[model samples]
Target chain A: MVKTDGLHFQYPGGEAFDFPNIDLSAKDHLAVLGPSGVGKTTLLHLLSGILPASSGTIFIGNTEITSLDRKALDKFRGSHIGLVFQRYHFVKSLNVEENLQLRQYFPSKLKDKERREAIAERLGLKAHLKKKVTQLSQGQQQRVSIALGLIHKPKVVFADEPTSNLDDVNCERVLGLLKEEAKLCGSSLVIITHDQRVTEHFKNQVVL
Target chain B: MKLGFIAYKNMVSKPLNMVLSLLLLVLSVSLVTFVLQLSKQLNGQMDKNISPVDMVVGAKGSPLQLVLSSVLHIDSPTGNIKLNEAEQIIKHPFVDSAIPVSYGDNYRGYRILGTDPAYFERYEAVLQQGRLYKTTFELVAGSAVALKLGLKIGGKVVSSHGLAAAGGEAHDDKPYTIVGILEPSGTVVDQLLICNLKSVWDAHDHGDGTHGDEEHREDESNLGNEEGNDHTQENERHHDQGDKEHDHTPDDDEHHHEEEHDLHDEEKEITSLLVKFKNPIGLVQLPRFINENTNMQAALPGFEIQRLMGLLGSGVKTLNGIAMAILLVSGFSIFISLLKTIRERRQELALLRTYGLGTRKLLFLVLFEGLFLAFIGFLLGWVLGRLALILVSKYIEAAYGYVLQINGPEFVELLLLGATLLIAIIAVFLASTSIFKLNISKTLGDA
Candidate 1:
């Protein structure tokens, strides 16, 4: 459950832009579509509590993130939100299994072995779980990043350009895995992407 | 904590860079260690070189030079004074005891000292062989002299005509019988030969020895009837002319006794005196009294050692200062490297930040990297410094005859090293300000 009322943000030394008010609840999948420079990623970052809003009241389960200090906000984000980046952001030195294990560094109750195996099975990453992130193919790394996003079973998953690097089939597989993991955890999914192909999987759409 | 380990792993990925940094740190630390150890060894040798004399009553000269000559055996005596003057000074009310040392002969570059039984007692020297010199020709050799010359008790060894072996003519008939060997004290005495004052007199006494001054008769007579072993190799080649020149045998017995006493009083040949007061408190007063009242000077061991430390310590401090500067520069290098690394990993860090790592945790990651490098380099340098000290100790002991204790790095050293690491880590954190200012939205958009 999340909501933002008149959320506004601006790059430092730039004019502020206000985002339209929006709301989402359990198990709802929202596709955020916008041009490259229209702050699609900014909205996702703000929703995920990774960026401060110039003027906003963002709520996740009735708690305003804008008022929290950097430390408190980080703890809040770790326990409640899972983020998937456009490019594969898996640590270069770690294997897919280790990348999944990184989720445990946050305050979470996910069992390392169980979460890794389940995510690998769902995303078809089981065959390459022990391979270093750098050693994986671009498509495989993207799958690993999506797997990492769902490993902690957060209440909400925020994806920024999640399908940009995936091919047609890999894109479908990545989106399918994200939706399946969200449904399994009773979590809502919000994806920001310039690619129009990902819109087919989500019932809800918010175009900027 | 997990992030800290991750940061450390990433920092060590460039093994060559890590090794280069460690090598620089080791080089600087080893230099500091070497200089400190050398100064320590030198100071220790200075103390050990000064032996049995409670007071260095000698002709006016630099006290340091006198100490260097008489105790260290490194220089010649100031000038010869009468033996009676030394004896009278020794019998003074405040004087506890005295040893008369006459210097002349050398065997293979080692100084040969003619001294009395008091030299042995004052130095707590033990005879390792036959006995102390019972007669004029008997000699007591130091451990090094015995070993280097291959001489043993009861063996015969000849003294060169002078201090140098190459220039001095051999005094074959005036051969010395090695009657005793001194136990090793790891001091300057280990490189000398100790004989009685009469032996020094007899070696050059033309009547007893075939080799005597033949040419420089005027110089010998200029000595004012004072008996000395100042008979050099030049005198040996020239004393033939003086073979029958001054007939001191014509002088009356009482006049000769008075002449001998005055000669002994005038030929004061002590290089330096090592004076000690009944109490350490007398240390301050005695040096002042000696410096102001007489031509001779006195020096307090502690004050002189401190002065020497100050003079020598400046060089050491300058070197340490350079080391510290390099350490600081390396700290900045580490900081810049880690900060640049974090900036390059902004998207990755932002991803982690989104996953609950805050600005503080991200900053901590960079800080941990800096600390990790410093800690490793510090440990490496400490071990390297100690190993360098051990290697240098052997060479110093052999060269200076002073046993240096190279063990025991004090707590202050460890504290200083720890502080250096702490500063390096802080520098890394400071350099990571760029990472702290990273904007997640801009980063993700760029990615």
Candidate 2:
């Protein structure tokens, strides 16, 4: 479960943003829709503990993430929260399987090769597992990025503009895969994006 | 799976940069190690050759040349001093022992030293085979000279007139019989051929002079003959006592007695006299006294060797400073490369932070890359240093007859390695501090 209350943030010498409260159970999904410079990414950052909120209480699973110290929040985020960025940033030096292995490593979890292969197979990336991330095409890299976000089976997964650069078909396919993976893993999904096409897919929506 | 894997991947991804940095480090480290080893061996060989003698008295010339020729045998003698003039110094009451040395001959490029039996006694050389030289033409070969010349007991060797064999006038009329061989002493004595002073004076006697010079030479020759007779009487007295105590052959005693009278007419001269005084007063006043009062020049081995070392040390110290500067520049290059890499991989690092990798792990990943390069560079440098020392050792042995042990762990090398690693670590730490202030959300949003 993921919940937030009275989330507010302000940049240094910049305008402040006030976010509405959110409540989502496991397997539910939320899409934060906003134009440019509307704090949609800031919401995702606050929700995932990537940026500290000035006055807010964020609960993921049973812990209040905003109250945790930096190290504790890092640990808590690693075990409970997963992040998928828009630009598909992978450690380009590593291969597809090693990227997933790194994600599994940070939470001090066993590198379950079977689970990794299973995730790759589910994302239709079985043939590209040994290939470097830079060698993969756009669609394949997107799928690998989705697998990385869900490899640890976190309780909450926050994605930032995951399908903004895709065509209508790829955008739908990526959104469908993300929703399906989140539902399969029983994870709450919160996606912050400016795209209008993804708004119809999620019933729980927040507009800034 | 581990952070080290990421570090390895990052290093291998840019092979050119990694190799350039490593090559610079290896060159610096190997140069320093080579200098350390060479200087250490040079100092060791020099200290081993510095005998207990206090001063060297020879004809007036360079003090360094005198010490090199008399004590180390690495240079030619200044000139010959008259034996009578040197005998005055020997008769001083404060003198404990005075060993006269004449060096005008060589066999196979090894110097033949004409000295008294006390030369072997002072160096503490024990005979390996046969007895010490008892006659003028008999010789005692050092172990290295014997091995190098393939000489054994009773082997005859003719003397060359100069120190080197090339273009040297061979004294075919005089030949020396190897009566004894000395054991290895790890000193300059190991490369010498020891005989009495009469042998050197007799071999150089050509008798070509004016009538007045001939008369003076004849008078000096008569003096030499008288000294030989006195030496022979002293030996005969000792031999008669030995023959009475133990059953010894009188035939050998007669042969030595006959050989002493042969070639007895020669003008006696010596190259130098190695001196040791009984008190500290000699160290203060003797060299001054000899330089001002006598025709001979006194050369202090310690002072002359210090001058030689000062000349050599400047070159080594300059090279060492250059090597250290190159090492520092290599460290800076490492810092720049790491900083550039961090900037280029900003988005990637942000993505790692998103995946729950902490700042400390990210810092370590970069630090480990630097340390890994240093370790590889250090290993290659160590091997190159040993290889260089081996080559230098061969050259030094061929040129100077000094053996250098090339393979050993030196304390300075370990300290250099530790200092290099510390420099690398500090460089990486300074370069990777950007990771601490990395704003993951802003970076990912910009990307």
Candidate 3:
């Protein structure tokens, strides 16, 4: 579970924002809807402990993420929180299987080839396991990005504009896979999006 | 799966950039290593060639030229001095030993020296075959001369008029017999043919068996007269003898001994005298005394060799500086390449941070990349240095008869390799600071 109270942030020499409180249960999903320049990515960054919240408390599971140091936050974030960005950023030199293995590597987790294959099979990436990320098509790359985010079975997964670049059909398939993967891992899902089409998919939603 | 694997992939993905940086590094490292090896070898050769002789005394001329001619045998002699005068100098109380050398002839471009057995003893030369020269017209060839001329004991060689002269006047009436061959000593002796002083006198003797003093004075004034004179008288006397008569010798010991004494008394001249002082006192007093009071010039081998090294050292130092500058520029190039790589890969680095790679691991990844390039460049540079040394060794040996040992690694090579790696690490660290200060969210959001 993730809980945020009186969340607010002020960028240096820029505007400040006072965000609404959020109460998210495990295995649930929240879509943050906003247009451009509305601090949608900033909110995700703050709740994920990537950007420190100026005046608020964020609790993921039992630990208050805002009270953690940089190093502890990094470790906590890596093991318990996952991030998926709009661009599907990956080490382009690595193949699909190796990319998943990299996520497993940093958490000091055993490289379970069976687990990797299972995740790849679920995302329909089994046939492209040995292909470099750059060789994959847009839909295949999007599924691989979801696999990367959920590989370690984090308790909370935060995605920033995950479907902005996809068409209506790819966007639905990507969102369906992300929600199914999040439910499979029993993790809370927070999707930050500017598109209104995504608002109907999540019952619990936040608007900036 | 490892960070190193990722770093390697990132480096090889842009092969052209990595190769350009590596090539510059290899060139700089090889240049420095080559200079170090060459300078060491050249200095070693110079030290080995400088014998233990304290002073070289020759007829009045340039001291350096006299030292070069008398000690190293690489220059023309400074005319001839009277043997009696040199003998007086040798008898001084402070003199330990003196060996006089007489040079005039050559056999197939190898110099023939008329000196005593002490010359062989001075060089620690051992006879590889046959016996030393005990009579006039008997010769002992050095190892290089024997090998080059295909000469053995009892072989005969006619002397030419001048040192290293081809098709010059030949002493056809009397040829010197090779009596001994010396082992290789890595000295000037290896290129010489040793004979008794009388052989040179007999070969240049132009008088008609009558007045020895007049002949000596005539030979002293015009050393070339013997070469210009017709060989009719000397040839006729040798040609009339039958083969058995030519091989015969006088049986009476007393008469042979008297003849040897008479030959010694004849007006003999030598080109130069090699002197060694009994103590340091002679070093201060002998050269000055000889220069002020005698007709000969005394050349100090140590002083002359020091001057030569001083001149060559300046050149070596300048080349070493240039090589170091090239290495510094190579370091700068690596810094720029790494900086550019970090700039281009900022988004990817941010992504890695989100995946749980700590800042320290990221820093080490970049550091290892630089070290890897340095290691490869250093190893290739070392091999290239050895190859260059092989080429230079062949040339130096062919031109100067000095061998350079280039097979082993020196201590300086290891030190240089360490220094190169250190510089590479520092360069990488300075360039990778952009990775440390990167704001992950901003970079990823911008991307």
The digit string of per-residue lDDT tens for model 1 on B84-113 reads 545554555455555667676677767678
lDDT tens digits, residue span B1-447, model 2: 888999899889889988888888899989999988888778777777765678899878788878988888887667667678898889887788999998767887888889988888888888999998887878999888888888999999998755666545566657899999999887777888999887875554432221133333433342233232212222243344322323333334444334444422222467889998888788888899999998789998888887899999999999999999988988888788888888888888877777777899888888899899888888898889889999988886666666677756688888998988998998899998889999988888888
Per residue, candidate 2 scores C-alpha lDDT tens digits across A1-208 of 8888888898878879998898888788999899988888888889899899889798987899889998888888887888887778888889999999999888666678988998898899999999999999989998998998899988989998998899999999999999999888788899999999998999999888
Alpha-carbon TM-score of each model against the true structure: 0.74, 0.81, 0.79
Q: Score candidate 3 by lDDT.
A: 0.80
- What is the fnat value (0 to 1) for candidate 3? 0.58
Candidate 2 Cα deviation (angstroms), residue B339: 2.4
Residue B175 accuracy (lDDT) in model 1: 82
**DockQ preference between candidates 1 and 3, better one:** 3
Distance (Å) between predicted and true CA of B246, model 2? 39
Q: What digit string (tens of lDDT, one per residue) describes model 3 on residues A1-208?
A: 8899999999988989888898999888999888888888889889887788889999999999999987888788878888887888988777889889988878566588888999899999999999999999988888888998899899999998888998899889889989999989888899999988898899998898
Instruction: Tell me how candidate 2 scores on lDDT.
Output: 0.81
User: Per-candidate DockQ versus the true complex?
Assistant: 0.47, 0.62, 0.59
Compared with the real two-chain complex, what DockQ does model 2 have? 0.62
After TM-score superposition, the amount by which residue A142's alpha carbon in candidate 2 deviates from its true location, in angstroms, is: 2.3
Candidate 1 regions exceeding 4 Å error are: A4-23, A54-56, A61-67, A93-98, A108-111, A117-132, A183-186, B16-28, B44-54, B57-63, B76-82, B102-339, B383-398
Candidate 2 residue-wise lDDT at B422: 93
Worst 10 residues of 2 chain B by lDDT: B226-235
Ranking by lDDT: 2, 3, 1
